[model samples]
Target: MIRIVITGITGRMGSTLLRLARDTADLRVVGATERPGSSAVGLDAGLAARLGALEVQVVDDLGRALDAAKADVVIDFTGAEVSVGHAKACAARGVAFVCGSTGFSPEGLAELAVCAKTVPIVAAPNMSVGVNLVIRVAAELARVLGPGFDVEVLEAHHRMKKDAPSGTALRLAEVLTASLGRTQEDLTFSRHGQIGARPAQEIGVQTLRGGDVVGEHTVYFFGEGERIELTHRATSRDQFGLGALRAARWVVGRPPGLYDMADVLGFQGNS
Candidate 1:
């Protein structure tokens, strides 16, 4: 069995992950953690209404939680600030990390990459298998379509989500930019007012927020007299939680490095 610890135990994803872990045979919840001064600090993680009853408490002290728990992997669904500390602590303790936290700045990502030199870390903005596959397909489409198509990405998330464009949207944009041999800054076009005609080399991104949308992404490829559209919609958070566990299992004994769902799905490095 894979002994696992969860960061962000009181959050929506964390609670959902706890429930999913209960049903998996190869994994066990060894620890759960929230930030200091959190109201959930002393609650039973396994007693979440959706998870019924088990023997795990939501903790606050990162060091104490990991030191007292016999976990082989730590799954982080926390914010980037907290995740940075989690990464450092997990690396120092030689624990594998599966991070689903998003919205990290370039500098924060650089820090995580440096941390990965000491401990294996599997990180993805969106952990759904289908979403990862969409990235592969979108990259191929961008390569084949070249610059003829005016690419626009649309994403919708729940009102409670804090980020704009969604991380998955940004990843899709990254893949498209790479496929077209362009940097994100060179290709991304977000503007208003009397904007000139769309540039041949630019990709546009639009975002929407409403309701309880689990997640949704649509890629539009427009050409003369024709258009191709590719989309992926997530119906629940369980898929993300399950995919994270799958990644955690895959990174169990691997060497220290940065990895993503593409790696988990066995895609080419550049994909």
Candidate 2:
């Protein structure tokens, strides 16, 4: 059986992962962690996740958890800084890591890359299979449609989501820009009145947040006399949780490196 620890066990994604891991074959929840002061820190991870009891305590320190559980891998869904720290801790102990956290800055990502040189790490903004597939399909569409098509990306999430323009949205934009041979300078995050006509090379990204909507994203390709829309709507967080668990299973015993869902899913061109 694959022994695993989960970070942020009380959060939406964490709870789902805990439950899914319990039900999934060949996986065991050996440890779980939450923020140091959170009420969940001392509770049974299964109880905290409303899964009765699975004999795992929720701690605050991931390193201690990893050592105590003799964990094979750690699945983390905490903040960017927290996930980076977890990755380092896992690297120190030679435990693989699967992170589903978003909102990482350039420097934080660089830190993750550095940690990956020591142990395999799967870090992704959105771990849903459909979203990863959309990333690839969007790139292909951009390549086929060419620059004549005006591209715009729109994404929505719950109001509590901290990041504007969800990481998935930015990933889509990144692939789109790459496929079109453009750069970050060609992507527009916002616009104001009297901004003039949209530049031929500009790719627009917009954000929406309100209510309890799980997540939603749409990529539009507007061309003469026709337009194409590629959209993915997530009604629940289970997909992300399952995807992370899938990555955790695939990452163990692998060589040290940074990977994403595309690598786990075996997508050819884009990650």
Candidate 3:
């Protein structure tokens, strides 16, 4: 069995992951954790009725939790700050890490890469398989459509989401830029004032926030004569939780490096 430790045991994704992990054939939940001072500390891994009963308890000391459990892989659905510590602990113990955390600082990502040198790490902003596939298709569209089409990405999330544009949006931009041979610094995030016509070399990003929208993303490729739009709407968080679990299973006993969902789904030409 693939022994796994889960961080953020009380959060939305954490609860969902716990429930999903129960159904996974070859994976077992060895441990679960919460940040220091969290109300969830000492709660059952199943989150007190949110999920059915699980034997594990949600603790604050990640190192102690992982060491005691001897987990082979650590799945982190925590925030960026907590995930850094989890990565460091997992790296020191040669434990593979699968992270669904987003909005990491540059220094945090640098630390994660360093950790990857010691144990495999799969980190992604969004863990939905369909979203990653959308990224792949968006890249192809960017390549074939060329500068003739104006590219715009629109994303919507729950009002509780902390990051604008979402991690999926940024990843989509990364793929599109690589396909078009441009850099993210060249893209446009907003247009309010008397901004002239849209630049052929720039991609536009827009965001919407409202009640209980799980997640939604749409990419528009527009030209003078035609326009094409591709979209992915997430109805539940279970999709992301399941995808993260799938990645955790795949990264077990693998070599050290950072990876993404594209790698999990075998998307061709991904770097």
Candidate 4:
């Protein structure tokens, strides 16, 4: 069995992960954590997730969780800074790390890279397998469509989401830029009045908020009288939780390095 810890155990993704892990045969929830001073602390993790009690109490610190559980891996769905700290803790303990947190700054990603030198780390903005497949297809579309098509990405999420232009949208943008041999400098996040015709090489990304919507992303490649749109809509958060579990199972016993869902899904060469 793979012993795992869930960070941010009370959040949407964490709670979902806890319940799924409890139901999975080969996966075991060895520990769980929440932010300091969270009300969920001290409660049985399964109960906090409304899954009854699993005899594992949610703690305030990841270090304490790791110490108590002796986990082989940590599944995190917290914010960027918090996830980085969790990665460091897991690295120190020689544990593999899987995080689906977004909005990581350059320095934050650098820290994760450093941590990956000691322990395997799988970090992806969106952990849903369908979304990763969409990302891979977006790259292929960008390559096949060529510069003749004007590219634009539009994404929508729940208003409570803190990050604008959701990480998945940015990941799509990254792949498009890489596949097309264009730089991020070609990215255009906004368009205002007095803006002239769209630049030939520019890739536009737009954001939408204010909804109970889970998550949605669409990549548009517009050509003369024709457009191709690749879209993925997340109806529930369970796909992400399940994907994290899949990553947790795949990451254990792997070599130390930074990996993404593409790696876990075996899309490395094609993606």
Candidate 5:
């Protein structure tokens, strides 16, 4: 079994990852991390997940957890604030890293990237295989359909999701923008009172949050004759957990570099 180190062991995705690891035969939980002074720290990870005792302890220090657990790979679902540190620590220990965190600023992303030079890193805003496929197809549609088709991305998540438009939506916009040879400024978050007609060059991203929506993204390519809509909806968070587990399993023994779900799923999109 591959020894898995999980960060943010008490969070939603972290807990889901823990529970999923229980059923995965090739995987085993070795260590878990939480923030300093969090009440959940020091709890038995398996017991915390209601999986009885797997003999893994949840602690606050990521470095200590890795050393104590002798982790082979770390699956991080923590936020931007802590994930960079986790990546750095894992790389120092020669441990593979998989990050499913969101809301990372440019500097934060750069910090996480530095570790890829030493250890394999799989970083994706959304880890679900279906979402990655949707991005590939969206890029293909954008390339084949050309700029005549205006693109818009619509996303919805739970009310507690802090980031607007969602990271997955932004990723889709990036894929479409890159395929169409457009700039980041081409993304339009909202069209309000003063904004008149939709700019032909702009791609709109709209967001909706309510009623604990797991996650939903729809890409609309509006053309004169025919329009195409590509969509993916997550009925449960276990999909993300499962995808992360696969990434954790695949990243080990690979070259030191930054990768994504496309690399994990082996989907080749014409970039």
Candidate 6:
């Protein structure tokens, strides 16, 4: 069985991961961590996740937990501020990592990549299989449709979601921009006031947050006579939890490197 360490164990995604890992045939939850001072610390990770008790306690000290558990891999669904630290800690211990955290700045990502040079790391803004497939499809559609088509991204999430536009939406925009050879400067986050006619190469990204919507993203490629929309809506977090677990399974026993869902899913073109 794959012995696992789960970080951010009390959060929505993290809790879901805990339940899924318990149910998965080849996985075991050996350790879990939460941010320092969080009330969830000191609780049995499984019990807190409603899985009764597997004797895995959630601690705030990640390094100590990893060492104590003899964990094979760590799955992180924490926030950006702590995510890099967790990666670096895992790398220092020569433990593989699977991160599903979002809202990381470019520099944060670069830091994670540096950490990956020491330990296998699979990090993605979103870990749902459909989201990964949709991003790839978006790239392909943008490539085929050419620059004549205007690209726009729309994404919605629960009110508690920390990041606006959602990391997955930004990733889809990145794919669209890359496929069309448009750089970050060509992107427009909003069109308030008199933004004037949309620039010929502009890519628009919009956001919405309310209620308990799991997640939704729609990418539009608009041309003069026709338009194409590619969308994915996640009704629950189970798929993402499963995807992260799959990534955890794949990252173990591999050489040090950074990977994503595309790698886990066997999409060679993106990898």
Q: lDDT, candidate 1, residue 34? A: 82
Global lDDT scores for all candidate models: 0.88, 0.92, 0.87, 0.94, 0.90, 0.90
- lDDT score, residue 65, model 1? 82
Question: Stretches of candidate 4 above 4 Å error?
Answer: none
Off by over 4 Å in 1: 48-50
Error of 4 at 177 (Å): 0.6
Report the number of the highest-lDDT candidate.
Answer: 4
With a 3 Å backbone cut-off (N, CA, C), the pairs that clash in candidate 6 are none
Local distance difference test, candidate 2? 0.92
TM-score of every model versus the real structure:
0.96, 0.98, 0.96, 0.98, 0.96, 0.97
Q: List the residue pairs that clash in candidate 4.
A: none
Tens digits of lDDT, candidate 5, 33-87: 8889988788898777676787888899899998887788999988877889999
Ranking of all candidate structures by their lDDT, best first: 4, 2, 6, 5, 1, 3
Q: Model 2, range 125-233, lDDT digits (tens) per residue? A: 9999989988899999999999899999999999999988899999999999999999999999998899998899999999999999999999999999999999999
Question: How far in Å is the alpha carbon of 114 misplaced in model 4?
Answer: 0.2
Candidate 1 lDDT trough over 10 residues, lowest sum: 45-54
Question: lDDT by residue for model 6 over 28-63, one digit each (tens)?
Answer: 889999888988789888877777887988899889
Looking at model 3, report the run of 10 residues with the lowest lDDT sum.
Answer: 44-53
Task: Tell me the spans in candidate 5 whose CA falls farther than 4 Å from its real position.
Answer: none
Compared with the true structure, the alpha-carbon lDDT of candidate 1 equals: 0.88
Candidate 3 residues lying further than 4 Å off, grouped into runs, are: 47-49
Identify the superior model by TM-score, candidate 2 or candidate 3.
2
Instruction: State the TM-score for model 1.
Output: 0.96
